[model samples]
Target: MNQLDIDKMVLRLNVGYNGFKFKESDLKDGELKDWAKKNNLLKSDDKQKD
Candidate 1:
């Protein structure tokens, strides 16, 4: 997906789980990427054995 799609998806999913009160300043691009990795929503490092 493009950046816009990713942004929308992140915002919707974040707020849905968090609540409308989550300050946008609390997010970073890396956090989104991290979430995708940790939960397997995207992918994890191939060399990661943890």
Candidate 2:
């Protein structure tokens, strides 16, 4: 999937899951990318293992 598709999927799935209320227009590209990365919704480049 492309970035747009990934963004939409993540937003839809995460909303209301952990008290997060995200709308389509609520976040910008960078913000969404950061949020996704932080939440592990997207591939993380972190070298540290869990």
Candidate 3:
């Protein structure tokens, strides 16, 4: 497996996170909805549509 390191500060301004941590398996398993929910990017009504 390969890993990438990102600066949390840079990401915060762009993706709205002061700090973030993730494993490659998250992507591999297609878990972005979980991520969005954690970041408050997904609304409950939006989830119901899916």
User: Per-residue lDDT for 1-50 in model 2, tens only?
Assistant: 78877876767576536545444244666866666656655432454453
Candidate order, lDDT descending:
2, 1, 3
lDDT of 1 by residue, 12-49 (tens): 67556754433323445576655544544432234444
TM-score of each: 0.38, 0.38, 0.30
Worst 10 residues of 2 by lDDT: 41-50
Superposed by TM-score, candidate 1 places the C-alpha of residue 6 at a distance from the truth, in angstroms, of 0.2
Q: Name the regions of candidate 1 deviating beyond 4 angstroms.
A: 21-50
Query: What is the per-residue lDDT of model 3 for residues 1-50, given as tens digits with 9 covering 90 to 100?
Result: 22222332333344455334333233332344455546543335332442
Against the true structure, candidate 3 reaches a TM-score of 0.30
Better of 2 and 3 by TM-score: 2
Question: Can you give the lDDT of residue 1 in candidate 3?
Answer: 22
Segments of candidate 2 deviating more than 4 angstroms: 23-26, 29-50
Error of 1 at 31 (Å): 22
TM-score for model 2? 0.38
